[model samples]
Target: MSQDIHRITQATLDKLREEHHHLTTVGRTEIARVIEAARSLGDLSENGDYHAAKDEQGKMEARIRQIDTVIRNHEIVERDGEATEVSYASIVAVVYDG
Candidate 1:
C-alpha cells in the first residue's frame, strides 16, 4: 500500500506540530486524571463516567495518531503571494451554479 503525502503550508505544519505536542502532553495528562477520577468511583461495568472517559480517550488517541500520520507524511509547501498558478497550500475561489 502506498501512503499519500499531504501538502500543507509551513505555518499549518507548525500548528499541527504544536497541536500534537499539546495533545500528547497536556491533553493526555488531563485525560488520565479524568480517567483516574472516574475509576475511583468503583464498579467499572456500570460506570457511565468511566465509559464516557474511555470513549473520549479513544477519540483523542485516534486524533493523535492521525496527526502523527499527517506530520510524518506531509510536505511543507511555501506560499507565493504573486503567483498566477495554483500550488499546494494555495487558496482558491470556487463558484457552483446549476
Candidate 2:
C-alpha cells in the first residue's frame, strides 16, 4: 500500500512549519516549566494546576505531531498559477437585485 499525498501552498506550509517549530520548542519548554512550577506546589494527587498543564501539553504535542505529518507527507506547490478555477478560498459573493 502507498500513502496518499496532498498539495499545499508554500505559505501554508511555512505557517505549519513555524507552528510545528514553536510547538515542539517553545510550547514544550513552557509546558515543562509550568509543570515544574505546579509540581513545586506539592500534592500531585489533587493538583488541578498540574493536571491542567499536563492536559494542555498533551493537546499541544498532538497538534505538533499532526503538523509534522502534514509537513512530511504533503508537497508544497506555488500559488502563483494563472488557473481560473474557482475555489472556496477565491469565491466571491455578489448580491443580485437588492
Candidate 3:
C-alpha cells in the first residue's frame, strides 16, 4: 500500500513560505542574541540561559528542515483567469459548523 502526500493550496503554501522566512531570519537573529547573552554570563556549563538557547536553536533548525522539505515537494496549483471562480491563491471565508 502506498500513501499519497496531501496537496496544499497555493495560499497555504505562501503562508508556509512566509513563516519559514520569518523563522530563518528573525527567529535566527533572536536565538543568536540569546546565545550571546548566555556567553556573556561567563560559564556555559552552569548557565541556564545557555541551555535554553541551545534547545531553542535545535527547535528552530528542525522547523527550517521541515519547511525546506515541504517547499521542495510543493506543486503549484494553477489558477483560472475567471473572476467568477475562486482560485488557488484566493482567500474565501466559509462558515463552519463544528
Candidate 4:
C-alpha cells in the first residue's frame, strides 16, 4: 500500500473503524465456520464450496488490511463551514450552458 496520508472526515474515520472491527471479529468467525463446514464435505480437491469459502476469506482479509492501513495513515479533518472556497472534503456542484 502507498504510504501517502489520507485526509478524511471524523465520521468517515469512525465508519472505517467500525467496519474494521466487524471484519476482524464477526466476519472472520463466520468465514471460519463456513470453511469448517466445507471441509467436512469430502475430498479437498473436489470441494468447490471449500475453495469458494477460502477465496472469500482471502478477499475479506485484504479489505481488512486496507482499512487498517487507512485508519493508521489518515489525518482526521473537519469541514470548514465558514470558508468561501472549495477545500478538502468539500462538496462541489457545477452548471454549464447547453
Candidate 5:
C-alpha cells in the first residue's frame, strides 16, 4: 500500500511511456511541419493557416508538458510473491450486476 505509487500496472506504464515517446518525437515533427507550411503562406497577421497551426502547437505543447509531469512524478508499484491481496497496480476482473 504505497501512497506514491501509480494505480496503473507496469504494462500500462510501458504502453503510456511508449506513447509519450511517440508524441514527443513524431508529434513535434508534425507540428513543426504545420508551422512551416503556415509560415510559407505569406502575411502572418491575416493567415488562417498560421492561426490554426499556432492553436495546434499550443495544444500539443500542453500535452507534452502534462506527459512530462506525469513521468517525473510517477512511482512504480511493486508486488510481493507472498502477498495474496491486491493493491495499487493490481489488475482485477469485475462482475457487473447491471
Candidate 6:
C-alpha cells in the first residue's frame, strides 16, 4: 500500500506534534479520570456518563492516530523560490467538507 502524502511547513508540523502530545498525555489522563469517576456511580449497564466518556475517548484516539499518520509519513516542503511552471497540481485545492 502506498503511503498518503502531506506537505507541511515546519511550524505546522510543530503545532500538530504539540497537539498530539497534549492529547496523548494530558487529554488521555483527564478522560481516564472522568471514566473512573463515572464508573464509581452505580450500575455499568445504564451509565450514560461512562458511555459518553468512552465515546469521546474513542474520537480523541482516532484524531491522535490521524495526526500520527501525517507526522509519520508526511514531507516538509520549503518554498524558497517563485513558481516557474504552472500545472494542475500547482494550484492549491481548498475544499470545505465541514
TM-scores of the models, in the given order? 0.86, 0.80, 0.70, 0.90, 0.69, 0.79
Q: Please give the CA lDDT of all the candidate structures.
A: 0.92, 0.83, 0.84, 0.94, 0.78, 0.88
Candidate 1 clashing pairs?
Answer: none
Per-residue lDDT over 18-53 for candidate 5, one digit per residue giving the tens place of the 0 to 100 score? 878988899889989999999998999999999998
Ranking by lDDT: 4, 1, 6, 3, 2, 5
- Model 2 residue 23 CA deviation (Å) reads 1.2
Best by TM-score: 4
Q: What does candidate 3's lDDT look like per residue over 1-98, in tens digits?
A: 54335357787788889999999999999999989989999988899989999999999999998888778777776665555777665667799999
How many clashing residue pairs appear in each of the predictions shown? 0, 0, 0, 0, 0, 0
What CA RMSD would candidate 4 show?
1.8
lDDT of 4 by residue, 1-98 (tens): 56989999999999999999999999999999999999999998999999999999999999999998898899988888877899888887898989
Best by lDDT: 4
Residue 6 shift from truth in candidate 1, angstroms: 0.6
At residue 60, give the lDDT of candidate 2.
Answer: 93
lDDT of 1 by residue, 23-76 (tens): 999999999999999999999999999999999999999999999999989987
Q: What overall lDDT, based on C-alpha atoms, would model 6 receive against the true structure?
A: 0.88
- Write one digit per residue (lDDT tens) for candidate 6, span 1-98: 88889888787899999999999999999999999999999798999999999999999999999999999988887654566664322545568998
lDDT of 5 at 45: 99
Q: List the residue pairs that clash in candidate 3.
A: none
- C-alpha positional error of residue 41 in candidate 4 after TM-score superposition, expressed in Å: 0.2
Model 5 poorest ten-residue lDDT run: 1-10
Which residue pairs overlap in candidate 2's backbone?
none
Candidate 4's TM-score: 0.90
